[model samples]
Target chain A: MKRNDFDFSQPNKQSYAAIVFLAYHFFRILVRQLWPVLIAVLVGRENLKNMLFWIIAGISVLVFVFAVISYLRYYFYIDNDELVVVKGIFKRSRTNIPFQRIQTINIEQSILHQLLQVAKLEVDTAGSKGTEFSFSALSMAKAEALRQVVLEQKSKILPLPQTSGVEKISGSELALQTILHLSFSELIRIGATQNHLRSLLIILAFFMTLYNQVEDIGVDTDQVVDQINEEVVYFGKIAIIILGLMSVLASFTFSLIRTIIRYYDFTLFRTNDGFKIVSGLFTKKQISAKDHKIQYISWADNPLKRLLGLYDVYLKQASSSEVRDTKSISIPGCNSKNVERIKFYYVSPEEWKDLKNFKISGKYIYVRVLYFGILPAIILGSLMLFTDFKIYSLLTALWPLLVYLAFRVNHKKWNFAINHELIYIRNGIFGNYFKALRLYKIQSMALRQSIYQRKHQLATITIYTASGNINIPYVHLDLAKDICNFVLFKIESDKRKWM
Target chain B: MEFLNEQIDVKGLPDITDIQAEKLAANYLKVIFITRGLTSFIFITGIVVAAILLKDISVTIRFSVAGLLIILFIWFFSLSSKVFNTRSYAIRQRDIIYTRGLLFKSTTIVPFNRIQHAEIVSGPIDRFYNLSSLKIFTAGGSQSDLSLPGLLSSDAARIKSFIISKTAQDEEE
Candidate 1:
């Protein structure tokens, strides 16, 4: 730890403690895939209890033996400029990851790992040929030593890297500056600010999917529903209200627990040339998003978060979408000041003023409102007029009204700003989302228009970055073209590397 | 760092609004129509046969279905012509632009430096006509990639080499 550097040129197997992790992983996968079968055998009509017990014991022992063998087989070493991993028993295979392509080295610590004072190190590379292997168990000092070697600025890799993912989390000492830290109160506030409505919607969707699956499996869902309905009617509206309240309460509690587990004692630090975020409770994770690799920075607040004076900030790094999903980092509960600091570190947010501003046409909502709102409303109205379902009229009136309100909110929140260096998009409804990107970072530009938009002289432009994309919908056709051309010019003229 | 945020004069910049984009080979239109026409004819003919043979479907409905089959062919040919005209490509000094589509029209631009790779491809019919397409890949992944079909094989090869050279120059820089 004091040296901050060590050698791993000699091949060595993982720590003996790795067997515990390997066995845990093997058993977890077994239970995850066979839980239903396990339950069926246990509760089934057949009395083959002795056979089942023997089978379980046999599998467990076999799993332990396999884990031990795997642990013994796994060997890693640094050979030249590549990190080499040689593993597998019968079907031998080896992987070589160059230090240049190794984009990020992250650390994770489960409860067991923490108790054993060991950590899991996951190595993520840039492309589809990703080296997404991990050491299931390694001493913290050894993992740190490996990271130190790989992340060295002057290490032998082709065309020296501009920004390295030099990082610090809880243990290994490295040069890092504390940017922000969340107190216990802030964590609670963050949990409180989570959108319970969204969580509830997801839960409802999950249950609907589950019900459909059960119905497909020959269950009499309608009969079950009728019985539930009868019970509900017998209990009356008060009981229904209580049930709704309980579900809402359950969703809120679920959101809070998830927030705490994922972001307990969150800390953001500024490394020499990048941003490092360390978080989690039982499975501690630490990742660094290098300055040059970060393609876009976004921050937003929901209605609740806005009330609490906090914003959730996300740094999208350069990669394909699949890799980006694992690479990107989101920091919740950053106040306006913290967000500004983060934004400043990436791009000068203050320089956004005096830049050209563009608005998505008011007609943007017309297609949505007409198709999604009014058309359905009109269809339902006619249906109600033709049929005896009088309650449908109320529904017909209710839908368009909600859509129109949403339209009003969305219209207020849609627009973008751009200058020679940066593109800032402001969007969202009832809250605010700001996505800031550098013009030169865009990998491609797409200008789109539907027939209706062409008739109205409107167009949309999508600027694709390595991480994701920013779409400005229904701007003036000419404006979209101009923005596209300007971005292309910037990309061509600029010599700076996007990654 | 000097004047990095200078106000961009968009008017002075190169505009792709009315460039003389190179149209796809004319005979390739035959390729497009031939393939689509064959598929449409087979399906429509099958439906026509079904319409004529089915006794339970009724006369008015059968005749209307028969009428729609002809109209569908007419509509398909007309739409295909319009779409064929919309497809064109232009190469700038540092980037390539592809203009395509009729209903949901789109124009995509990919800078050479940003392009990960480019390749020339030809289907069997395309090979018969000595026509190939150039696909430009970027780090932005598949959706943002551009594919320009209906080019002469020589032209496709030329464009692929040009793109490769440009990207290689960036690496050298």
Candidate 2:
């Protein structure tokens, strides 16, 4: 269908498919709300049968009526260059978003929407807390037409140079220029390399939930624990080893399944304007941010990922105050060459090569040791003098060694650099993290000195960007001041757009 | 990269310490004393009420607690006075600099172009004294990056207008 076929001037309701979507959502919510009653019916099956039937029937009818009412009440259209949405059942709200203020119009299609050939449209405005307006379901044709009209109006206001001819290209032709694609094996590698501790904790939490549910069903947990203890004693040390190995295997499998589901058919494509990443098995998320909007780019590789030659690259864009994780696009399973390619797009290749590195002051090591080691040691030693935890006193003896190791690793990892308009900060111990941002993108800068730092003539400089703030902690006061001045000078002089 | 290779003359650059910032309003000290005095009065009243409620408590213990609170309040007032004296702000052509704190000193520089908005607000006590506070916000975060309290209402309005105009001009560029 042609884009001009839709009558955008008149106020209109969404496609009838929206009612189906709303009904599905409302039904899900109703089920969640009635979960306690459902559990009661499950426990007292014979006695509550009639009550449960009536309750389900009443809730289903109420949810259906509510969803239909909500669908009927919602209406949106473009009026006087503003996207106006009038919606509500009782209170009634009219949201008028000026075309010039719209930051982005995101279109998403869930499985149900895809089946119905409908899309969910979300309009985001700059300076607002979150999504300004959301239409749960709209016809695909109308969604595209609305997006084009909004973009046209935005271009009229901003006068941004159009990166034309992108729409004409077919999907297959665009796929030919795929920059990064994670194969099944690579996804497996990423899953296996994930931090085992986090996966173990997730597994533990899952079991804890089950344990709680069992307790709620009147099971004696103490009896279960006593039986488990008897089994453990009968089986002895090998039983503990077997259990540990089994838990480790369970975590690994869980992580593998999660990665498979999340990153299935992960693909990144470089377009004329910027990069496009399409991933997710069920949700099918498509994220595209222009190159200019990108404020920072960072990549990290843990020891396991390093062995497999894999790193996760993150592109952080200028975001509103919400701080949603969606502001950044993370592409895992990227090799070193892919990382270089991605960096080349954001930063100039020559500038990337000539970054002048500087190490943080060694005093950071002393401070870290004092806080992480000596203080803990003192607390534990004092506690041992009062409490009967002699084992904790023995653990106190290990603090000095821990402090030494931490200081060595911290000193080795902490470093930052500058080159032309770009500032590079690299830190982290087991995982090597590298972040780079343009100096002009910094919104503000601060130099902080604690009493201890003041005595040592050391200070910490923090540079705030739209995505997040970066800190160069425990640097020589003189050097920090010089860097701050240079950064401010660059920010004041540069005429380029920050986002 | 060429810019990094070039040497930056640290000595030639304007140092925050050397900028010679202007102090807050002359009555700022008086304002602080009044506010602190009011707070301490409330705190002492609460303690006295508690002591009266607990009839079994000895008079000596109650008197000692009161004495300790008074001493602590005096010490806090002196420390706050020192901190107030250290508070200062400087306005450059392109940015505003604010420095505060007696122990953990911090110097914040927010460029004019980066400011999202500026507001001039006066509280009851500040209004009584004809003083106002200028708050400068940035898109970098939710909190205002620079908030300078204890300015004469007129000066606060002037600064607020200047910042608003600067922000508008920056947007144009």
Model 2 over residues A267-314: C-alpha lDDT tens digits? 998875578877877767666766767788999999999999999999
TM-score for predicted model 2 compared with the true structure = 0.88
Q: CAPRI verdict on model 1?
A: medium
- Which residue pairs clash within candidate 1? none
Cα distance off (Å), candidate 2, residue A139: 2.8
List ranges where model 1 is wrong by over 4 Å.
Answer: A1-7, A32-49, A153-175, A205-226, A321-327, A349-353, A379-391, B1-8, B42-74
Candidates' C-alpha lDDT = 0.83, 0.81
lDDT of 1 by residue, A7-76 (tens): 5887867878899988888888888787667665676547677868887897799779989998888999
DockQ for all candidate structures vs. native: 0.59, 0.45
True contacts kept of each: 0.78, 0.63
Q: Itemize residue pairs with steric clashes in candidate 2.
A: none
